[model samples]
Target: MFEDKIEKMNENIGTIPMIEYEKRVYTPEEIQDILGVSRTTIYQLIKSKVFHSVRVGGQYRISKRSFDKWLEESDEEL
Candidate 1:
């Protein structure tokens, strides 16, 4: 079922060649690597709701889209 959904999503994306989609959910560790911040900072950001995140089984999952949006907004603020 998962494979089928992925295949269907890929097929849909293939129809729009101009659009590039990366369906990724980042773990806190991965976000830290991307942001060059510590895990504690990541948790703090999650706690402060600096960006959107969903907690699953005591772990927070940050969507790439939200992270990018937050980055863009922060850059504009600066």
Candidate 2:
């Protein structure tokens, strides 16, 4: 069924299909859980640019790199 169709498509294209993986992006909900904080606090941090984030649709996504940088700097500041 699905596998056969994929094989046929691959045969026609003559190239192995590359698996697509979603980029690791963290949502505010996950951040809140990780930091053990409220959503409002997360939003506040985002507003202050403590974490690098981009608005996708109505939600925000924080880059893992940006979050890691913040964590490292915050630790040094402590």
Candidate 3:
């Protein structure tokens, strides 16, 4: 009986959809690679508040959404 209950619970769990979340936050190294800029430039931009970012545990994480918005605004300036 216990084995049957365990099997039923496993089946129920399997029926639930497994959701996977994408990484929306990026590190300074990742931003450097994405923007093709140096680490110094990335830090400068962060310090200048040109991009929206959050500092967690002494590290800055930039959101993909904010970066996209910045890109749009920059394009408009040209």
Model 1 TM-score is 0.66
lDDT of 1 by residue, 1-78 (tens): 999999988888757768687867889898899889988899999888877899899888998888889989989999
Best by TM-score: 2
* Tens-digit lDDT string for candidate 3 (1-78): 999999989989968998999889889899899889999999998888887899999999998888879978999999
Number of the candidate with higher TM-score, 1 or 3 = 3
Candidate 3 residue spans exceeding 4 A from truth: 1-18
**What's the lDDT for all of these models?**
0.87, 0.90, 0.89
Consecutive 10-residue window with the lowest summed lDDT within model 2: 9-18
Q: Model 2, range 1-78, lDDT digits (tens) per residue?
A: 999999888787747668898667899999999899998999999999987999999989999888988988999999
Model 2, runs deviating above 4 Å: 1-23
Instruction: Please identify which of the two predictions, 1 or 2, would achieve the higher TM-score against the true structure.
Output: 2
Candidate 1 segments whose C-alpha is farther than 4 A from its true place: 1-21
Clashes of 3: 0
